[model samples]
Target: MKVINHIREVRQRKGITQIKLAEDLQVTRQTINAIEKNKYNPSLELSLKLAEYLDVPFTSLFYLDKSEENAE
Candidate 1:
């Protein structure tokens, strides 16, 4: 199983820069970068905040993957 975050895609689609997102989230750009790279997992509160900021559902930003599902 792998944890995947679609932050980069969502941000791009929303035309939002990492720095801007960081500022809105009150986090560092590095933290946003880490989350985008899957190097860090945000807390539930942060996740909800991100969803709100991006105008996306929480699941649209993050998801769980199964090996079998990924293979398809």
Candidate 2:
């Protein structure tokens, strides 16, 4: 099953621009874009840092879809 995330939603809700978040994380805007679009999954360290940066719980940011898992 694919792992999807609500990173974009949370980022938007906080009014944080991709560039701003990238700058804060010392990553490229393209990297942020990739993450938001689910084309890339951040590392465990980065994930924790992102959750901290967004002021949210890690669990709330990502989850596995049972539907996707069961579809097979």
Candidate 3:
């Protein structure tokens, strides 16, 4: 299964910058970038924190893709 996220879209929509989000979350901007690029998967604690910080539901921010092919 692949983990997909709408973090960039939601964050952009909310006018939140990667640096700002990272600072608020006590993480590095590279961490946010990697997560946005699908190069990293956040831990459960961080996932919950992201949802809470973005004021979005967990399902709205992240989901699973069961297909074998790449999402793109």
Please tell me which predicted candidate would have the highest lDDT against the true structure: 3
Looking at model 2, the pairs that clash are none
Regions of candidate 3 where Cα sits further than 4 Å from its true position: 69-72
Deviation from native of the Cα of residue 25 in model 3, angstroms: 0.1
- The model with the greater lDDT, 1 or 3, is 3
> What does candidate 1's lDDT look like per residue over 1-72, in tens digits?
667889899899889999999999999999999999998888899889999999888887888977767798
Model 3 lDDT tens row, 26-51 = 99999999999988999999999999
Clashing residue pairs for model 3: none
Q: lDDT value for candidate 2?
A: 0.90
lDDT (10s digit) by residue, model 2, range 4-59 = 78999999999999999999999999999998888888899999999999999999
TM-score of 1: 0.87
TM-scores for every candidate against the unseen true structure: 0.87, 0.93, 0.91
**What is the model-wide C-alpha lDDT for candidate 1?**
0.90
lDDT of 3 at 50: 99
